[model samples]
Target: MRNVGVREISRRTGFSPATVSNALNNKRGVNKDTAETIRRMAKELGYERSEHLDHIRFVLARKTGKILDEGTFHPGVIEGVERVAAQLKLQTTFTTIELSNREAAAKQAFEITHDMSNGIVLLGTEMAEEDYVLFRDPQAPLVVVDGWSDRLFFESVVTQNENSAFRAVTYLAEHGHRQIGYIAGDYRIKNFPLRERGYRRAMREAGLTIDSKWRVVVGTTVNTSYDAMKEWLSANPPLPTAFFVENDIMALGCMRAMTEQGIRIPEDVSVVGFDDLPYASVCNPPLTTARIPNREMGEIATHRLMDQIREPRDYTCVTHLSTTFVERQSVKFLQS
Candidate 1:
């Protein structure tokens, strides 16, 4: 008969909990002979370190609650990470900090991580370049998701922001749409800018003139997007035949604003969005959008971080998972 857990082994070995943990994780500061003794005692006590460790610490960084709250893209990524970790018989834990105070958040994260024997997967969705620089180094191995930096590089896994946005916009062009507008959430994450770049590139490649007035930047949430779009519509500006919005939530809000103004979806303005959220399929008229493989990104980041933990890498790698363009009823075909 064998018991599972760390404290039991710690008590029997006459070692502090921290020493037991450090020895189990193969972390330094524990004397080599003492660590070996602890391991022997752990084995005798039937403490399965593989099941308890190979662990990862997930750090959710938030600049604001606007996008980091429940029911958003980040949760899917977390689920993916957890699912893979379980398959490997590894453990997962969480910590959160506010990027609103960059220095304090960075310092807090570093201090907390100092004692951790696990690698970290940072939720970089809302992180800016300056924030990235501030957290460029940590006491533990790190992987970042949904964000990247020109100045700093970590083993990163991100969505194919530019490719997906380009595909969405190009789909509109193929449907005989020359006048395509853009809608984006107002935020400081790296994803939005890449999505916008894809939109711009696609428009240019298609030889379609981008109407500067058609580009609207609104709040990151559905309510704020709705309010902003509604206010913009109140001005009675001419609407484009189609729009490629930043994400499904913002798309829904913009859709509501348009419908309220007597603008028929697909009929008046065909629209495409990114992130095929659950609501996309059930909406009044289904939204045609690019589905980001959020969970896959999270899983990959975990694996990558684990690899680094197993064998330290001198060079970092970045992985960008592509999206699936889901065609629904939101876009209407036209003839020139």
Candidate 2:
């Protein structure tokens, strides 16, 4: 007969308890050799395990239960979570929440912890302070991707928006472009604010003039951004040679607006965008944007949440991942 606890397995197999748990859970960060040895020992000891079903049963008994479904994914963020869940051989459940009312959304999120222990993933915008309060006791594991609350109330996996935006602007400046324009996202969102600050800081550092006409704050929707871009292009006679768009969605809108005006990308006006969504590569002239590690970010978020579930943390911790610049045909090199 074999012992089922992680400590017993660790002692029998000469592996750490963490390694034993990770191997049993099929999580990353454990050495293959160690995991294999632990598994072999379990098999030798006739330690019959009931597969993920047993774990699922345990999870279901928790007061905070969640279904990992399409409900959490918003637009570009869904594919990554779907891939991660598939890789984990987990069936996800989807639930929808309207962001306009934080209380309603929080209530829905709160109820998920009651009978589903699969954990919760927030794949859209960050949660509000009031919303975070709903999970103060955390009935189950919770992870936030591509966004963060005021504090690390829950585990988060997100790209470094501020640094990425800073680097994007620096790259443009290095390429000798000074007259830059910006189409920003909602100011209420923390990630967008960081990105805007990065863009402004980079511009000021380069000693370039940031024309008031060059900056526009568009709403969260792509259509909203498109209308704002069109208005700006129509109202201003002098358009900047280059533009920095907050996300690929907004960039698509700006692209349409610019094309209607008969401006060619990189030739008449250059553009850089964030998020590097799937369509970014297929754009007329592939967009030169910052690539986000969406899949890896999702996977990490899952693991982090699991960690919190296995061993509840005293406080929340934030993890910020970096982004890379993908040079495409969208931006033109302006030689001085």
Candidate 3:
């Protein structure tokens, strides 16, 4: 008899692979009929429960619990973390960091230290290294997501920011764009600072001068992006042929400002953005951006935390996820 694979099962049952996997694992969210069909296929394939799988299942069950809350970063990370935590028999809790006050955010994190469960995950763009150290201890295991701090000595998961930013800008430069402009977000955080460094490095490697009027560093909001772009455009008589935006949110604002003044993308101004957020593909001309593996990174972070908590190992690891350049309608190829 042929072995039943996830894809084969999905094709046969007309259900998604995720649904089939859920049913096979006895996870919630799949209907009874779907579950039965999945089991039947498994049985037909002579699938037998292995001891390793059972122990793995037991650990997973123990790891996932009631609620696993996360802060600041997108909830998509929480979903992946929860799934992995559930596999380990624990749940995840999510909360938002108060951006207005660092002390308030720190207090909230300290409060979570007293939760029913000991495991914690924190995600924040503005979280400092010192704040992370307070949350991390030998007894209580914590994972820092998307931020890097030298003061806090703990395991972390970071998005591949520098390389991704370099790729986006280099793509423009390679395609005959020398007089390039940059719309950057707040440089207070480590990642953005690294990205800024990457941008400067790219510009220097191409033998291009860094003009003050071409760089805009401001808050990570749409309004900030709009105002920054507007200021740059007004101050400079002629705009660059291409521009690189820090994030999708700001990219939207930059596009708005450009369009309002009758500037066209790829025609009058070529544009590329980081973070292929949900709205990136649906924008006016679609956004050419970098895609981050948010969910997978979250899942890996959870699993790493669980291992540290359970095994009490001496291995301290830092994981960096790579980003992909997604070609879309936003960028215009200028043949110069």
In order, candidate lDDTs are 0.82, 0.68, 0.67
**Model 1: residues with Cα > 4 Å off, grouped in runs:** 1-54
Model 1 Cα lDDT, one tens digit per residue, 1-336: 463455566778889766877788777799999999999987777766331234777888888877767346888888988988888877888888888886799676655444335777888877877777656544467888888777976888888999889999998998899999999788746788889999999999999999899999887788999999999999999989999998888899999999999999999999898889989999979999999888888889888876876776568888888899999999999985
Backbone collision tally, model 1: 0
With candidate 2 superimposed using the best TM-score fit, by how many Å does residue 33's alpha carbon deviate from the native? Answer: 50
For every candidate, C-alpha RMSD to the true structure in Å: 6.7, 11.2, 16.0
TM per candidate comes to 0.82, 0.73, 0.72
CA shift of 30, model 3, Å: 52
Query: Number of clashes in every candidate structure?
Result: 0, 12, 24
Error of 3 at 141 (Å): 1.4
Better of 1 and 3 by TM-score: 1
The best-first sequence of candidates by TM-score reads 1, 2, 3
Q: Write the residue-wise lDDT of candidate 3 on 1-336 in tens digits.
A: 353355566677788755765676676777898799888977776653322111111111001111111112355676677788778776455565553455675465554542324465666455655556545432345566676568656678888888888878888888888888877765355676777777888888888877877777654666766777776667555787887887777788888888877888868888888778888899888999998887876788777766764576655678899998999988777675
In model 1, the Cα lDDT at residue 71 comes to 42
